[model samples]
Target: MDLMALIQQALEASGKLRDLSKKLEDADFKMILADLHSALADAKLESGELKIKLALAQEEIVRLKQVIEQRDKGKPTYNSEGVYTFEGEVGRFCTACWDSDERKMRLTDLASEFRFVGQWECPKCHAGYGAKDA
Candidate 1:
């Protein structure tokens, strides 16, 4: 039986045992009933703990689904120079870093006075590509 069903049955048995014990006058029978009630109480408590853990597991599943959906919506697209654009975002990223390592490393503009001026360089892999002049 499921934990919840077992808990419900145990609680019902405990209540019935209590009612039966109240009508009895023998000390031995009363003591046995008391012990059974205590055991049922422990069983119910353990089942409650399992129920809480089950709820937490369900919540974790929902959170993981949300992460997967977000990743799907934001998956990047790369161009010929290996620059990438994400959905609904303005800036471009380095495709070398993303394609090779799945890292979204942004490209930095090359030093203005350098030979590679007007180009962007990947901070992660040191790859360079010319900027799109828009």
Candidate 2:
């Protein structure tokens, strides 16, 4: 059974045990005692089952996390060059390329081409050619 179901069962058993203890002074206490014992046993078994299920769930979570980390490690990283290439749909473009001779054209100039190359604002134009721009 699932963790939630086991927990609910355990809680119900505990409540029943409390009620049984409250009536321990009555003549029918023997019958209630037997039922409480059975409930206690069931609660213990359910608790063990919950522990096993939690361990399995934790193991799977760790495995999935490792898989994600490995996948991210395999991906390409972009540095100061600002150029990155990926295997499929993912790609990175040099932001400075927009201000260079290679990208003198603008969005308004690319009416026929129907495509914009590099970033919207030229990094070179904003930062200048060297650190002096700062």
Candidate 3:
């Protein structure tokens, strides 16, 4: 049983013992009552410690869930042009790399002198965007 339930039962039993003691004047009964009270006090202390641990565990679970949600939200999504948007941020990503491997292969703009101007190229896969390869 859990510490809380055990502590609660101990408390209830202590109350019943006290009530029963009032009807008897035996010395042995009084000694037993003293021991029961001591044990109940110890149980109460242990219950408090268990409650703190339970609270800490619950807090950790909440923190881990929040971290997972943030990671999933940061994942990129594909646009109509087959490029992935970086968590809604500016930047055209390689859809092939991201969709196939979850790798963020950013596309770099080709220079005007390269004939591939206004196009983006994947640094990792060497794939070209816009106008295709001549």
Candidate 4:
């Protein structure tokens, strides 16, 4: 069983032990039982705090794993179009943007937007890709 559950069980068991010890006539022996119950209660509280910390750490681990998974999937296949193309993503991406900044900025075909036909450009970095590169 998990440590928190085990601690809870221990606290329950100690409480019952203290209750049963109330039948004894000796005062000093009953005081020791009370002290033992107090320590078990403290242990239960400490276990609860530890359980919260463990949950937060597990969440952090999941977040980091998702980042790693994205990086692995982001490995693009370079087509004959002189640009990087990520899976399930439309259009070509700038190589300089990915290499330098790890950003997947889409490259705009200059033929439709500008005077430079048969050329592409990165909007963020302004890096040009000529038809000769294709």
Best by lDDT: 4
Lowest lDDT 10-mer window, candidate 4? Answer: 109-118
Query: Per-residue alpha-carbon lDDT of model 1 for 1-134, expressed as tens digits?
Result: 88768778877887897788788888898888788778878887887888899899999999888767757777798766657988887777888777775677778878777534447888888877774556
**Residue range 41-91, candidate 4, lDDT tens digits:** 888888888889989999999988876876987687788877899998898
Off by more than 4 A, model 1: 1-6, 23-26, 68-84, 87-134
Q: What ordering of candidates by lDDT runs from best to worst?
A: 4, 3, 1, 2
Worst 10-residue stretch by lDDT in candidate 1?
Answer: 110-119
Model 4: residues >4 Å from true position, as ranges?
74-88, 91-134
Total backbone clashes of model 1?
0
Taking the candidates one at a time, how many backbone clashes does each contain? 0, 0, 0, 0
Q: Over all chains combined, what TM-score does candidate 1 have?
A: 0.43
lDDT of 4: 0.81
Residue-wise C-alpha lDDT for candidate 3, range 30-75, written one tens digit per residue: 8889788888888798879888998999999998887676568687
How much lDDT does candidate 2 score? 0.51
CA-lDDT, candidates in order: 0.78, 0.51, 0.79, 0.81
What's the true lDDT of residue 84 in model 4? 93
Which is the better candidate, 1 or 4, if ranked by lDDT? 4
What would the per-residue lDDT of candidate 2 be over residues 32-124, giving only the tens digit for each residue? Answer: 666766776677777788889989999999988876764564544444534433344343433344324333211112223322342322334
Top TM-score model: 4
Name model 2 segments beyond 4 Å from true.
1-27, 75-134
Between prediction 2 and prediction 4, the one with superior TM-score is 4
Q: Write down the worst ten-residue block by lDDT for model 3.
A: 111-120
Tell me the lDDT of candidate 1.
0.78
